[model samples]
Target: MEMHIRSLTKPDGRQLRLYSRHPIEHVENAPSPFPDPLHANPHMRWHPLRGEWITYAAYRQGRTFLPPPEYNPLAVTRTPDNPTELPPGDWDVAVFDNRFPSLSLEAHHPPETIVPTMPSTGKCEVVVFTQDPQSALGKLPLAHIELLLQVWAERTLQLGRHPDIQYVLPFENRGAEVGVTLHHPHGQIYAYPVVPPVPGRMMQIAAEHYSQHGRGPLEMLIEQELACDKRLIYRGEHAVAFVPVCARYPYEVWVAPIKAVPSFVELDEEQRADLARALKTVLMKYEALWNRPFPYLMAWYQAPTDEQWHPEAHLHAEFYPPYRTPDKLKYLAGTELAAGLFAMDVLPEDKALELQNVTVQLEEPAHA
Candidate 1:
């Protein structure tokens, strides 16, 4: 479970860290497409009606989007003259400070407005899943996938230690349908100064449920899903993946450890390994189900990183696929958008059957 890390400061003053199972040696300094220093000064405004904070970063409009097939910024730097975000090295994963982040640690000087305003004092980072831009997460080896879980655990522990950060969310948006301009297999980490609305309500409800019954809501749901076995996709020794009975999306699926592990930092070796298996199973099924690349928003939810124990929090991942069928997409409109209530056209059991029919063989790479 040992990981070697090499930290480097990019020419543009951004931070880059490379991780590997073996020693990360003989790697050149990190590179950046921009040469000038990035002076990010994002701010947050209070929404009186929603009772929440809204972050603003006008510069994010200029972020790299839909680049030509020849040029990928996430790719390893080929020549020193035209460098990319990463250095050519034998690293499994790479993480760097986002050039156009919605929130920044250096944010300051909020402008006067009618609503309350403050500096967006948080962090946004991009996690490059692999060196190859064409590869997908499910195509990775099990050992490599396990390494990603470890990387997430390390990031959560490090970012959570900051006093200004209250919550950390790791999520991925796949395909152009999900507004992913970059086709690279990667995800993002958002360390928030405050707990966001969705996870905030989730924690509140979980705490209430845990108080009434000595288990979290997800844990109780997991027990029921396991007992029912109708919507079950992959049920491992320590982890499980299933379609929830009350799914909001047409092809929605949930993955989690059998036992309630509050966060990635608390997952044992068994739980982490099994969790990777379950994740890969779902991703592979999604691809095979439609005979094409599936587009989905995958989000991992854990406890708030406010330096307090949260026994009610249960670590889990939810996958919201956009497609209702092979060709048609399920759009959120009317009641779904205005009322915050999701309308599903298909049943969860029916969608679960579609994924369960696809067979996937988890094989290790020859080198591994």
Candidate 2:
């Protein structure tokens, strides 16, 4: 697969990196109808009480909302009448800089206030999985999924190498229930300047576990899940997907590498393929469970770019679906929001059994 790379400098001076498997027709002076306002002055404030970094991107309030199908920005430009983000052509997979990014490459000096604050200096990009806007990741072929994984790994490695970035997160928010503003089948990659609270806490806990048990928490957890075999959903050669014992959501599944790997870039070809299969199985089960499209937040947790924090970290993908049943949606109530306490209605083992019994019919081709 020959990939042609090109760079486009937007009118607002933001650079968009374009990669495609086929030749890209260069547009000399394409008019950008929606020019960036250049008002994103994001800053991170230290939450002294919670000991976490709180990012404030007020400019994101004006981001593209639920637009009509004709105004889908992620779709390929088929005619001059509709000029999307990508060049006017079809693409297997395409990635470019996000127009309304949470963070920016151009660091800014925050205001001088009593509260501790720093400029949100990082990067954000949109990864378009397919040219067909109607398709979802679960419905894509295995080969396409594998290629998407490769793209994720490449982006992780590239973004993690930046000195300003501390953590690189690739995540997808599917369906309107999951707060998806766009209907297109795509994901976003966020390179954070500082490690987020959840991952930071997890890293600390894993380090403590390693100090006591002399093994990573992820490795131990995987071993225990495999031994119990009750909550395990799908066990591949190199990866495993299971409903965690203390699952906060009704159908939450944690997909992790059997081996102790720090990030996706460490995965070999076999491991990547196994991960693709494991992810597909879980997604198919979700689709079958409701007999409708499954809305979920697919989040990838990787090790921090700092090498010192690498040994204790492990790569994992977590699915947080809001639906408790076909018509019911689980909303984070007071306890969950105020106290950070989760209330799950279903037991993990029972949910696992229910998912295991679900029969998934794959109508799409497995491979390209």
Candidate 3:
């Protein structure tokens, strides 16, 4: 499949990169309406106590809220009167620059202040999973999910090559409880100029473990989970998904490649397929657990792009579902928010058993 690429410079000087498997003529004939001009004033402040960068983008406050269905911006445009972000046509997958990005490549210069600060020179792109806005990721066919995975790997490789970007994160926020402004079934890719805090701390721990032992911490964790067999959800040939022994959320699941890989770009075709299947299985189980649309945050943890290549760093995806029961949602309060400590109500082993009991249902292809 040939992907046609084009760049458009928005009125606010931000560059939008468009990627589509369809012909360029299709996109040109039905160009999407330009979004309202909005400038991003992004800057990163040094957190002296935490020793991490704190990004602030004031313009994001005016982002589109929960608009009505008729005005869904992420939907594929069907008519010129209702043009969305995507051009009017059938597209297997589409990617474009985010209208209200928290970070941008064309961010304004940082002002002089007593505290140290730097320009938030990064890129944020939206990954539209399907042409149909209402379709969810788990409901889509395995082929479409595989295509989405390919796009993610491509973007990871492309964004990681940038000299300024230090970390490339691909993630999804589903449902309003996860703070999703749009109801579309989509995800996002954030290329951070600096390594984020969570991954930074993870790399540090992994490095310490590697120095103490020969193998990486992720490999050891997978082996331990397999040995226990209680937390193992799905074990594929190339990938494995299991609930961590120390899960932070009630239904938290970690999916990782059996063989250590630093980033999605390193995964081969077979590994990608296996990872997709493992991911789909976990997502399906989540919905089946409550027999409703599950709300969760899917976060991909990949190695940084900088020269500090930690051999112990392994690629993984973590799911943090808010629901602890059918109607109960886990809210992060005092202990978790202020003290940075998690208190789980359900045991990881029991949750894993519950997920393992749920059967996987195969669905027909929703998109080509």
Candidate 4:
């Protein structure tokens, strides 16, 4: 898989990168809506009881909200006067520095707090999935989707090289119910100075499991799921998607490679191809379930970029849809919010069956 990339500096001194499978023929200078350079200085405060860092970025409140269709910021710049984030190009995907980042590499000057405080010297980047604002991730061509996976691998490698960045997370929040301010098909990457609490706990558990059994918990679970043939959504040669036996959400689904691949960069060509199909299968099922665009939070988990070999870490994607039923939503209550325990009304098997019933047809990979 050969990927052509071009990097440019926006007017605001932000980095913009354009990627495509084919050689990029047309190009325009990158533009920014904001004329001034970024002044991002986020800080992290220690939570004594929780044993975690809480980041505070007051500028995020002023980020772009649900703007009118005419003012879509992710759209390609149409005129010189009306500039958008992306320039006119033949790029399959675009990535740029977030104008209102929660964490920044330029962050400094920790506030004088009683508790521990430090500069959030991390990175935040926005990934525009496509030039078309109307299309969704699952709707893209298989080859295009594969390119995205490659792009993610590239980003992980680039961000992980920074000594200050210990972990990198790529995630997407779709629909207004999930507090998606922008209707554009996009996602964000957050590189952390230290491994966050959730991933830290997950890594600890995986490490323990690996030490005891010589395999990660997710790897063991995948074997059991494939053997049982129950709660399986998509079962490809190199990858699989299913609802876990211990799913926290009613319609939760997980997509992963059959092998215990640690991160995006570790995915082989066959694994990457099959993983893309598995992802598309689950997403298409979500939209077909209700015959409308589905709303969900998709997060990818992988090994931390702390310059350590992690045989315990397994690469996977988790989908947490907001809706339990067609018209009903699964709202988090006291137990879920306060106590961190989730109570599901429906069974994981039933939800799996529901998704299994929805049929989706995918087209072959496209090439020019």
**Better model by lDDT, 3 or 4?**
4
lDDT of 3 at 328: 88
Q: Is candidate 3 or candidate 4 better by TM-score?
A: 4
**What tens-digit string does per-residue lDDT give for candidate 3 at 178-282?**
899687888898999988999988988988998998768998989888887889888888889999999999899999998788888778878887888888889
What TM-score does structure 2 among the candidates reach? 0.90
Give the TM-scores of the predictions, in the order they appear. Answer: 0.97, 0.90, 0.91, 0.97
- C-alpha displacement of 15 in model 3, angstroms? 5.3
Candidate 4 residues lying further than 4 Å off, grouped into runs, are 62-69, 365-368
Candidate maximizing lDDT: 4
Give the lDDT of residue 221 in candidate 3.
89
Counting clashing residue pairs in each candidate, in order, gives: 0, 0, 0, 0
**Model 2 spans > 4 angstroms off:** 1-7, 18-33, 36-39, 62-69, 361-368
Candidate 1 lDDT by residue in tens digits, 159-244: 89999999999999999999998888999999999999999999999999999999899999999999999999998889999999
lDDT of 4 at 197: 91
lDDT of 3 at 153: 79
What is the Å distance of residue 203 in model 2 from its true position? Answer: 0.6
Tell me how far the alpha carbon of residue 120 in candidate 3 is from the true structure, in angstroms, after superposition. Answer: 1.0
lDDT of 3 at 260: 81
Clashing pairs in 4: none
lDDT of 1: 0.91
